[model samples]
Every structure is written in structure tokens, then in C-alpha cells.
Target: MNYIDNDPRLQTGKPAGIDKISIWIHPFLIREPSAFHPSSGNNKKVILRYTSRNGFSIDFQAEFFDPFKNIFIQILEYLIGLSIRGILKSPINKDFSTVEKCFCTLFTDLFAIDCIEFYFDFMRGHLILSNITNQKYKTTRYSNNYTREGKSVIIAYDRIERLKYVNQMNYDEISSIIYPMRFEFKLNRTNCEYLHPTNIFGNYNVIFDNYLIFLAKRWRMYNQQVVSIPVLNNLYYAEKFKTIIQYSQWQFPYSMMNLEKTPSCPMPNKSVKLKDIDRNWAVQFSLKDWV
Candidate 1:
């Protein structure tokens, strides 16, 4: 039930995709007064919350990036439901009120992006060794945050486990997510513009595609340095890793990376002693393994 598209990620029991995204729409874009209750604070100082009848909510403020409810997640769910407001599916129904139509039209608007966070489930044999950015990484038990308060924050953490430990969750409350090790890259408006000069605001697929672009770029590099068989990992990342080769900096890693090491044990008694040498007894990796 997790992926109705028969997405192979279900096989891995992991969630891999855009984990979270935040954007700022021009305040005037949403003028439903009934939706914005009241606030005595000045326009610059006050934040307004908007909740649609269907339980969709987004907070608004005039600033580019404020702590107010800058998250608009319901749109992602809407896209998953096979609804793209007529772009990918069917056009908007004509029976809607003027306000509804106005809201629907802006779905195509070039968004003034605020923040986009990309994440994935990270299991064993993963190490974030990329030092391409000039910023120093802030290390914590749960995450490696690069560029804490700048154009972006590239962080890798197992927040699910962090929550379990921090909140002292019971076994039942603990999340069943395996290898919850996740990589999150949050880009501010400036970095977002750099990645996609044309801008990242478009349909849901477009937003997700940009995240894919980043994930692919990293996957290509990370695969090479990994200690495990790249193909086995590729098989693990069927949902998201396959596209990485599309942006491989150099040629993708060869199947040889998956070679197994089998070490012979010492003889049963003192009479014979086996050498400590490691034996790669299995078959060599085949080129087709990556296919």
C-alpha cells in the first residue's frame, strides 16, 4: 500500500524521496479572509495561518524565510493522488467557486522557493565523505550538518532513532523504519536558484525531479567509495539510485566492487593452523550485475 505504482522501494521497506519541502507564495496569492482569522500585529510583524476546508494548511508571512508555517505539504499528497490540476491528468472542474479557481490557477505559478529538503533511508556501509562545499560540517551524534545557516544545509542523520532516544519512546512507539539513516539537503532560495537557474517552481514532478538530480549526483560519487558491493546497493536503491548514473561524474562503478571476502578458519585442533589470509573464493563480479 505504500507505493501504488508498484514502486520497488517497498521491497526495501524504506521511504526514499523528497522528505520535506517549504515554499513561500506571494501573500496576495492567498486572499481568502475567512481563511486568515485575525492578528493585531503589523503586516511585517504578524504571521497568518491558512487552513483549507479539506485540512490543508500553510502559514504565511511577508518575509522570504520565517519560522511561521512555511510548509505546504498537502500539495505533494494531492500530486500523489493523480491530480495535477489538468496538466498531467485532467483540468480543473468548472463548477468550483471563483476563489477555488484562483487558488487552482496558481498551482502552475513559478514558485518563490524558500527551502527544499531531500532525504532517504541510509543503511550500513555508507559514509558521507564529500567535502566539495567550503563550509565546515557540524557533527552530532545523529547528523552531519554542512552549512548550518547559509545557502543550504547538507545533513545526514537517523532522525527516527534520534526521536526514539530523545523522547524515550516505547518499543511500540519506535518507528519500524529500517536503516533510517537519512541524508537531507536543504537549500535556501539562493542555492535553489544556483541549482536550477530557470527556477525550481513547477509541477510536483519538477520539484521532485530536482531533488532526484541532487540525489543522483551524490549517489554516483558515494557508490565508488562505499565498502559494499555497489550492485547490491544499487539493487537496494532500485527506487532512487538507478537514476544516479544519468549524472555520473565519471563512468559508474564496475561490478567488481561487490567482491566477497571469505576467510578460512583455524584447524579444529593444535595439529594444524590455517593462515590468516582472506580468500575471495566467489566468482568475480560480472558487468551485467549493474544492469
Candidate 2:
């Protein structure tokens, strides 16, 4: 076997763009989440009403407006645009090595996160610039020779927060402020080989489950990951914690509002007639139920 081929580390990790990963994550994460949250009002519509940090209530809408605003997308646009524009006024793209250095430095400076976690997507000969911040994500192909049009959708989330629970605001409650914000990307499916087993913590298994529980109890989670709840199509990750006001996960359609038509019905059957409409009747059923 070839020397490079024989190495297991080489097999597990790709060498291309391994040196310049920070450039990738800084833009993609912000763009994708922006599309999901559009504007302040939209986030509120998506998220349930709740108070946090000094009587400030942020549904999905407010969270998108205030905090999760610019960390990634705007910065990426600036750097990439500078690269294309050859704008000497900007510090980046003075030289190839300096450009790479600028990307890494700027990325770490803005996100306060590590550069190694991002994976660069290469299609044909170009890099795919979607969902770069998410460590675990999938990519699809488009067109172009030097640049391949690619899209990425986030499968999971790794968020760092200051509260014992997610999105809670008690500055006095905060104890330690860790630098370079700690997080790992959540894959739609888990594979043991990629990460050290103990690193994952959550309701599902990956590696950091226990640590997540510890954080859940000790730190207030300022960061959040809202995705489609696997079992409940109409539900989101925050809707699940209905009983726990401090941190809510997996927001269901009914949880957000009381309505006649169930929030997430496959579509709607015009032929089917309804009488009294209550959310209780539409409890989310798992995939196994249909199977």
C-alpha cells in the first residue's frame, strides 16, 4: 500500500484545506440560520413566548434579532468579497499565506472557536461554502468547473451558553467563562469512530451526552440549535421541554398555538371532516408507529 494510504490518520482525515478550516465555518453557520429565522417577527412566530435574562423574552424571533445576528455570514461576505475585489483597503488577500492567516485569525477572533473543527467541501475543484460552522453536515452538488455549486443542511447542533439551562439569563449565576467557546457538531446519525466517545452529551448518543447533562445543570445555555424534531415533523427541538420553562426543547405546532386544524398534518385531507379540534389529539407519533 502507498505510505499515505497505509496511515489510518490519513485515512480518517483529508489533507486538502486541512490547514485553512477557520475560513469555512465563519460564514456557513450564520447564513443557514438566517434563512431559518429571517427576521425578529419570524423567529417569534417559530419559537414559543418565554422570558429570559432581565425580563427579556425571546421567542425564535428575538433570539435571531439580538444575539445570533452577525458572527458568521457578514464576516464571510466581507472576506470573500475582498478576495474577489482585490480591495487593498481591506487587510485580507494581501498575499496567499497572509490571506489564509487573515482568514484563520479573523475567524477565531469573531467566533471565539477553534479552526480545526470545520470540514471544507470540495466539489470538482472548488470549495462549497454552505453550513461551514457545523462540524457535522451533508453536501449536495450543483454546477460549475472551478467552482461547484453546493448546498449544505445542518443535521445537529453544538452550542455553548453561560446558563445552567439553555437561553437562560442570570449573569450572577454564571461561574466560569471558558475561552474559545466550547462546542461539537451534531450529525444526523452517530458514528463512534469520528469522535472520542465521552465527548458527546445529550438525550441521544454521540460522545458528549454526560457533559451536556452537566452543562444543563451547571451553566446557562446561551447558545441553541433548533432543528426538525425527528419523530415529530411539525415539532422543533425547543418544543420538547414543555414542562421545563427554563429550557424548552422540541417545540411542537400545538405547543406554539391552540388551533382548530392540527399544526402539522401531512398536508390536509379535504375529504376528512373534523369536529372539535384540540392539540391533545395530535400528539406527535414516532416513525416506528407508521412502520
User: Pick by TM-score: which candidate is best?
Assistant: 1
- What are the runs in model 1 whose C-alpha is more than 4 Å off? 1-14, 28-97, 104-111, 125-153, 165-169, 194-207, 214-234, 250-291
RMSD of each: 23.9, 24.9
What lDDT is reached at residue 277 by model 1?
Answer: 17
Q: How many residue pairs in model 1 have overlapping backbones? A: 3
Q: Per-residue error at 235 for model 2, in Å?
A: 14
Candidate 1 C-alpha lDDT tens digits along 1-291: 223125553432234544444433333223243534433223332233333321222332223221111123344333223223322222234222422443343332312334455545555444342333223322222222324456324455445656565565566655664555555555554343333222334432344454555545444544433212244344445444444455555553332222112112212221211232132211232212210
lDDT of 2: 0.25
